[model samples]
Target: MNETVLYEKAGAVARVTMNRPRVHNAQSRVLLEGLDEAFAEAMADHDVRAVVLFGAGPHWSSGHDIGTPEELADRDARPYRPGADGHHQRSWDWNVENTMRWRDLPKPTLAAVHGMCIYGGWMIASAMDLIVAADNAQFLPFLFQYQSTPWDIGARRAKDIMWEQGLLTAEDAHRLGFVSQVCTPADLDEVAMAKAHRIAALNPLLAQMIKRQVNDAQDAMGFRTAIAAGHSAYMIANLGHAFFDAENPFGSRKKMPGIDEARERAERTK
Candidate 1:
């Protein structure tokens, strides 16, 4: 347990919390490291049969912070260094690794989402077996807000959620099977905890086998190829000249026709 994340176990359940409320639970390198530690501990704890992930305050998570301009400049100025192990995983590895672990956890996992679930946060939630969203909880991939791209899995999932399918509502997500259940903010934890208890009651060995099988099936689907391509494309598009053009070209990339008055006028029964 660290200041950035809270980890605790009760009976058969392990609970992990994103503790940075002021930033809407947005992750930095330190928060990501905390998540890794929390997941590792829960995985090794014999008493844990299920994991529940939630944030401490209003938001589920807002995704990775871009940092201040000064901080970004400092990062660009720093030299890359190899670790004693002869390989240094980048800072983003913490987020990527933990989300993968959640998706592959031998025991069942649940996400209790409140306020915002944007970008990287949505990726983490998508990795879980079950999602319980509050009525007001928003799943904003926020692809529209960033100048830079998300991590690999995040981009793929966001595309599927926001682009390939038009699941713009919490009800739409429920209908499309993105979220397993919906409830009010006050009742979200109750629903998630109840689901976790039911899952925990199942045979842990059987649960583990089923989880591994799911991952095996995904591996057969060229999941790795899709993830790599999506990540590379996102980064290249964001880092290229278009991202910094005077007109802010990416702002017009949103295809939600009904959202803009100009687009609505263009489609006026003509």
Candidate 2:
């Protein structure tokens, strides 16, 4: 729908590619809107039985486009009232509502992840019905934003991941049941497309029903509720960042000393 995202259909499989390679396909508001439109188009096409989402670069996504002032300003200029609270609420709504919408899409969806799948990117991958990660892919919740690690990867492992600020290799993700499969970078696209096509070959109605059943099982375990609660916590955390972390108020408080420093601190504590 937009230059930020590309959509194509091959048989019953629809592919949505995030196209901002230079910025590691960072999630700017424009990019997010484009993604929504692409997914909506695929969902509305009756011929499309499955969807594949991936980035068109060395990395899937680094995270949100926090450093782009022009993009941020454009996003802020939207109908929303301008202020810290307004910004926080808007972000919370967008991230939670859109992700949940994608998660519940009737057709099965697969995410092909590689390189940096961190922060908001992690949330995107977690929402997909299945994930096919390149061997070089690394999953990091990047804890500087909303935390969905527990719901996505289970409680104990989530704790271990956050405690260590861990970079989860594809094999580690598969072992933890977070990734459906892992492939070499060169084979990632083929592997993901094959899986999508295979799933598409199944009775589409039954496939949708099966996906709903599994999601319902997860909901029964309070998965959706937990994510909502995390969103609330994320808001509170932002308030802290705005009030206490004055230097970068309205931004991630975890910004200081950078990710490397944070990881080193985590390793030392471990």
Candidate 3:
């Protein structure tokens, strides 16, 4: 694959690394497309029974590309997805369609996230079956894209994130049952790889069945319906005046809370 994404295999597990350190692995259309190809590669390989996603450089991801030069170039020159027309289809293709496809992959998937796991980063990690974050990771898991707030961390906490623009610490995420485990940055990969191998070693059929069972339970609770509704709202926001708040009377939003505090706390403790 292109340098935007690196794919490798170790025994029974496949590792997919997002490779844009300069931009903190921002989710350019090319990068996301490459990631999907890498995941498909792992799934096609019989020897690969599990997958682990990682990001290159200091941060896992800064979030979706906010008009980066590279991203703009791709939009001008390359096709995002074949036959993906209009805002709705394109948004559904990347944000919902591809996301759920990976989520439903028969093999188990894990994401080892570190640094800034912001909105889009959180969305990517949420697609995986298990998320093992570094203790120093900071999460801004807001209701965006897939709109996985309630399913990932419950409705009340999701509201707290929106109301206060909350930043999520690794400890807080673990306590809220969002992150499956938290480890030091030094041990993050090892811990995630171990989990991948352990799952890979299990009976493959049983593993797939277990995944389906849990996901089915969530779907029964209207997980997919809620996500669809959220996506519709997000598209509407894109169309008209959105993100306007009474507190920001200057036509510009104020700085978010918990950014400095969360970084300092994670740094000092680490």
Best by lDDT: 3
Which ranges in model 2 have alpha carbons more than 4 Å from their true place?
Answer: 144-146, 242-244, 251-270
- Tens-digit lDDT track of model 2 for 1-270: 789999999899999999998888888878888989999999999999999999988889877776566466876577465557676667766787888888999999999998878778888888899999999997777444445688778888887876677678899999989999999999999999999999999999999999999999988998788877887776776667532466755544344322355346546754
Between candidates 2 and 3, the one scoring higher on TM-score is 2
Cα miss at 177, model 2 (Å)? 0.2
lDDT of 1 by residue, 107-223 (tens): 788889887677677777777777888887766453332211233224455556444323234565576567788898889878888888788888999888887887777768765
Residue 161, candidate 1: C-alpha displacement in angstroms: 6.4
RMSD of each: 7.2, 2.7, 4.9
lDDT of 1 at 78: 56
Better of 1 and 3 by TM-score: 3
- Per-residue lDDT tens digits of candidate 3, residues 1-270? 678999999999999999999888888888889998999899889999999999999999877775678986876695444431464676788778988888899899999999888877888989999999999887876546798977888888898775565578889899998899999999999999999999999999999999999999999989899989998887666443464344542223233323355455445544
Better of 1 and 3 by lDDT: 3
Q: Which ten residues in a row have the lowest lDDT in candidate 1?
A: 254-263
Model 3 CA deviation exceeding 4 Å by range: 79-85, 243-270
TM-score of each: 0.75, 0.90, 0.88
What's the number of clashes in each of the models?
0, 0, 0
Q: Which ten residues in a row have the lowest lDDT in candidate 3?
A: 249-258
